[model samples]
Target: MLLAPKLLRSSPSPSALIAMGALVMIELTSACNVVRIGERKISRKLQRKGLDANTALLGEANVHYWDSGDSPETAGAVPVVLVHGFGASAMWQWHEQVGPLAAERRVIVPDLLWFGESWSRKRDFSIDHQVETLVALLDHLGLQRAHFVGISYGGIVVHELAAMHPDRVAKLAIMDSPGRVYTEADHAALLARFEVEDFADVLVPTEPEDIETLMALGYHKPPRAPRWVHRQVLEGMYGEFRDEKAALLARLLEQLDELDERPGKVTQETLLIWGEHDPVFPVEIGERLAAELPEGTRLRVVEGASHAPNLEHGALVAKWLVEFL
Candidate 1:
């Protein structure tokens, strides 16, 4: 069974307004990067939780990850690898769940190639390449199998990984990812909903307004913040590797048909977590995917949630993941 958290207020509180004002003041008066400052704070928290930042060079790609290094408390537990979506790095995306999930079992969170410190010189940005890189990262860590949780685009990657190398994946959790079930009509409708000709404009945000659009689409109750703060996020987080990221999005869409053509269903027992009002990939897609998967597959919809429930309801999502994995 899936548990739901209390719905967060859609409107901003007075305290939130005051904090936003202070952030604007900081942006105007100081040279400190607001996004980086926030990232550093999150990094310190994760460090305190026993996750160490490290890098693994996998031939063509350099993968940067946070590992809850081997310890007696989690010695015999199967490691859980958290794969983040298109927007920010893994740390920024999975910060909330990391501490809780890491407390019981080893958790490995890696920055996907072209995001954070992980990157590849090879021009290939297909999902298959991403799966290969993640497999290489696992091999580098000497982990033969692990439970995988992937959100958004990362979901597509992990789905491909499980399908291509079923032996490498013990259990799978897909959060708001469309996978091969996304059809051409779904792609067209997504563009029409966002009023953009290219989906990359929606995913690979380049402007402050783009970020606003993303938050609006991703969350049921998007947090209120000033435009300058959004600009800071755009510059600090989404600015790097803009072109490559756009290319990656394009390649993903282009390769969908190819992926669908491949044979066989994912044999591993799967869990699907979706936001009730996900505008990007609607909950209907999740229902369709669940029916197509193995007999034991299940879909758990979070009430009053949007595209990224893990961000909006992190604790609940983590609880479900811990129980399922």
Candidate 2:
């Protein structure tokens, strides 16, 4: 079963939605009471407002984005585009690369469809549709393509984008991505994990000071997630229509069940990056992606990082990407 918080009708509020999600469970027990108290305590400690960011409506979705320091024509600078993973918005990950990468290149970070303020007009979140949305976004911005960097589930989109718009993609980078072979077992595990007692500690986040605690259960030590980042991540992601999100994910899994993981139609240049400690997809998966991708794929790993090498350890990740691309 997928976990969706009922409180999010349209979107999640800033602080209240964060704490309440931790306490939203099926079981009514004394343990839940304790969890509620803990949530409240954390909530009081970190009462945050919404994130200060810009939004551009793409189709039926609100594409939340942050522009890097320089622009394409900022006197001859290559543009870099960043895409986030599942259950996360642009603000959640890319901590290390988005800002610093902007120093030399123009960076464009947008909330992917189904995860952030962005939505799918078809109410679908398939790889094909996601790739289409990205291509449309790029066309909207009047760009052919830039350096593409994505993490975890975002890697799936990177793969699709490269396959769909090889002409648009200049260089591709994926970190600990669930790019190929999205198994049903994986979905089952995610569903089971979401219902656990300390699920919020990982998914919803219980510790205001330690936002990384949210990914404690993950393989790699989740990157250092900031409070404001969490505020935007939680609100833009997991509020309202809880049941709908769950159903949608389930439907997506069902749809992926029939699709080809190794679509074998890729032509984009790619750099595959992974963290050895990644808890979710693990490091082994990265090697598998290298084998499946079209030729000229570069594979590298970050030592201390977890699922998101770029966010957990952005500086070095940026160095590798800046050099690789």
Candidate 3:
């Protein structure tokens, strides 16, 4: 069990120690199942709007997702898959755009491994396995090719899919992700920006305060909410599978070194959307990606937005996606 850092203090009263012990017990118990006030509302709203809960029994896991639109094989509409970053789930990340996009295209939003209701019994948490899992899901849905929209970590996975199986992917859009290979220099720069030695220190949060810190880092204007709301969100979204997620993080670090050491030229026409004030991967990264990608790739910047332009500027991002895809 990971211990929260102890505050250095003078000798505490017996009552205070007892209260602390009780709080620890509550936290551990709630880690398994805590009803998040805000998340529940948003989830229900998304479901009411059109997103339906569905499950796919893949090889190693039973993946749960909120899917919209008919399968690609059966429908004539263009297929578009939205892959979310490291956080809660597809429900949380793409809730704003799902309905709007589903109207015109066949939109599929999936929860990545160890996220939402998705989990793997096999110990393989490498990026290659993740790529395989997604491919399997696409196969299950009878999709041979589709446009992909990814945010942050999800962007990396879609970029990999395009590189490894270019014929299987049509168009690609990446937001707030370093699609290219990251180097030792990039690692140092991130650590310096976050004032943390490891990326996990910033990406993974154990406490409510840590979650808020992550939000502050990711968003230019973090939402103001009550303390209890933040705590509930953390316990509900991140408390489960803590160990597995940490293991996955370790595997991802190794894969970044091996799989994306030096990305080859991506031939597919790409649309890169970035927030002007993105604190995580700055606009410069997007500029670099545009230059590195083949000619005809476009970069669209959203002013006043942060890491997640989709959430910050949903209508504009949706317009771009519809036009680009």
Candidate 4:
């Protein structure tokens, strides 16, 4: 596969700008919904594998969660919460990051309000609101501090979480995410690209067909993804079954409307992670986001992978996360 790589342009000790090393990894030949993960761990690993991991509640919709290490008792064991991207659930993003992090510290994965089993007709999916909900989740679990790992839209959630409730967050890992002010072309591209497959159109119901076509153009290897996952998510996008999406999209659009051509509040120890081959937001955006943070923030670009590096190149993503998270 053709590869592109980026490095952190900073000195660890403020004296010398170290030349960060570059690495090349394999591009898998097949599209896997999940490469085997969460198998063994010191954190509490349950049998809720795949969609089977779903948890539901009556009045307060149950949010499915996976945890490895619990900080409730241990001193050094702080939790790491991973969030997914737009139109995807937590399972879709952290299928790889979850299991490995669970090996040592507590790794918590929750399907946000709109996506997965956490679907609610009342929950707000606005970026800020979602971050608030995340913080509340931590509070509910009696966790006061945790490392946050969010991808794409999820990355933005952590940005808000760190900014709004800085006391609850310990560190941040943002991967291939869009910034506070997404440009016209960039925003349109995010909303318009849907041509990866017929079902991709169905997945983003508002414009599933467009999204499917966009995927074909955006993904380094769209064909590498299975037709079924695309189909189910696509159909769910606009299908009669996704009323939750309608409510979520409404709030999300409200968030876009509230934007004022600038990033407002921000405070957190941040690490920006990106895929060198990412066709979604690309490396430039990642570089910009890292630059916008504190002087010492880090950026790592995984070579030979695209938007969903956690899926395409999980091990590499996991390796960096093991150290960063």
Highest-scoring model, lDDT: 1
RMSD of 2: 11.3
Each candidate's lDDT (Cα)? Answer: 0.89, 0.63, 0.79, 0.63
Per-residue C-alpha lDDT of model 1 across residues 145-252, encoded as one tens digit per residue:
999999999999999998999999999999999878999998889888989999888888878988899899889999988888899899888988899899899899
**Model 3, range 142-238, lDDT digits (tens) per residue?**
8898888999989988988888878778899989888765666776787898888767766778877888877787677888766776687777788
Residue-level error in angstroms, candidate 4, position 96: 1.5
Clashing pairs in 3: none
**Structural similarity to truth (TM-score) of each candidate:** 0.90, 0.68, 0.84, 0.70
lDDT of 2 by residue, 84-137 (tens): 765545655664565456667667777776565666557664666667777777
Q: Give residue 159's error in model 2 in angstroms.
A: 0.7
Best by TM-score: 1
**Lowest summed lDDT over 10 consecutive residues: which window, candidate 4?**
16-25
lDDT of 4: 0.63
lDDT of 2 at 276: 77
Candidate 4 per-residue C-alpha lDDT over 119-176 given as tens digits, one digit per residue, 9 for 90 to 100: 5444555676666667767876778989988887788778777867778888888888
Q: What is the C-alpha RMSD of each candidate to the true structure, in Å?
A: 10.7, 11.3, 8.1, 17.7
Query: What's the residue-level lDDT of 24 in candidate 2?
Result: 56
